[model samples]
Target: MELKDRLLTIAKEIPPGSYPVDVGTDHGYLPAYLVKQGIVSRALASDIGEGPLLAAKQHIEALSLSDRIELCLCDGLTGIDLSDKTHIVIAGMGGETISEILLRRHPLTQTLLLQPMTKVETLRRFLLKHGYRIEKEIPAYEEKKAYTVMLARYDGIVREGDDFFWTFGALPQSKKKEKYLYFQSLLSRLEKKQKGLQKAQTQERTELDRLAILIAKAKEYLQEELYDHHSGNL
Candidate 1:
């Protein structure tokens, strides 16, 4: 099964030899692809709805992977056991839903591959505060939309109040170009919002003040990237 750019990015993050548990499996294409590629010996595909789960089952069978991939119909990881899985892939969900899934009890030892569709800042803050260390982030552009894939693990370290990384991300060196584009896009939206709020006389003006700070910080980081690469030559 061929995966989309976002899903493919998430797939590539899965470590080899990992026994993966794919949450919100939808049609189970990811697990099928992983198994077909020989990245993992086996996997568990799960979804909350019966329809999706049934669809996943059929897809797995068609691939003749029924013996390799297990299908479970459940909500999040509520009733599942994590001992057998080394990594968990939760993608194509809103950040809030991902946060809620993590909020519930689960094995801290399992690495997480998450791709939040919206409210990523909220998800990043939650992960940092909850002792999950983001090891790396990969950016994927598909269908004219940019997506972020995060690989994180429980390291018992809490990072707090880093708005720049929380709003954008502290991308790995390999993804510097992606990081620059993300920050640039974010800066544009924040600047426009700041301009609108500046014309208002309400207490909301405080938001504009906050936006100024964020705008300045994002610009500084982006400029630093340019100086580090181009130097006086630019």
Candidate 2:
């Protein structure tokens, strides 16, 4: 089965011989792909909805991967047995939902592959404040929409992140071109919000201040990136 670029980016972070559990496995494509490609010996795919789980079951059965891929209908990691070597994948969900799942029951797994559909900064802040280290982030684009898949691990040391870190995470260290595009997208959104707030007489002061800071930081970073590209320093 062919996976989309976003899921493929998440798949690349899974090392060989690692056991993976995909939460919210809509169609179980990721697990099936991993097992089919022999990246993993076996995997567990789960979804909270019965319809999605049934679809996943059919897909797994059609692929003749029932023996290698187990299906479950449960909320995030509620009944799954997580080992230290297990890799948890939670994608295609809002950042707040993902955070709530992680906060509900902390997993013993060492590695996590997370891709949030919206509110990326909220997820970043939750992870950093709760002792997870975002080891790396990969940028993925599909159908003109940008997404990031993050590889994180628990270190048990809580730390706070600045506005830029919360906004972009480790994305600034990504490839120059992808980084530039992602930053530009973010800047555009911030500027649009700032303008709307400026025109509103009832705008919240705190939100306006936050937007200004983010916009300034984004411009500074973009300028640096462009200069480096021109100077052959990238």
Highest lDDT, which number?
A: 2
lDDT of 1 by residue, 2-32 (tens): 8888899888888789899999998999999
Model 1's C-alpha root-mean-square deviation from the true structure amounts to 2.5
> Which TM-score value belongs to model 2?
0.92
Candidate 1 accuracy as TM-score:
0.89
Query: Where does model 1 exceed 4 Å of error?
Result: 199-202, 226-234
C-alpha positional error of residue 2 in candidate 1 after TM-score superposition, expressed in Å:
2.7
In order of appearance, the predictions have TM-scores of: 0.89, 0.92
Give the C-alpha miss distance for residue 124 in model 1, angstroms.
1.4
- Displacement of residue 53 (Cα, Å) in model 1 is 2.0
Question: Whole-model Cα lDDT per candidate?
Answer: 0.84, 0.86
Where in model 2 is the C-alpha error above 4 Å? Answer: 226-228, 231-234
- Give the best candidate by TM-score: 2
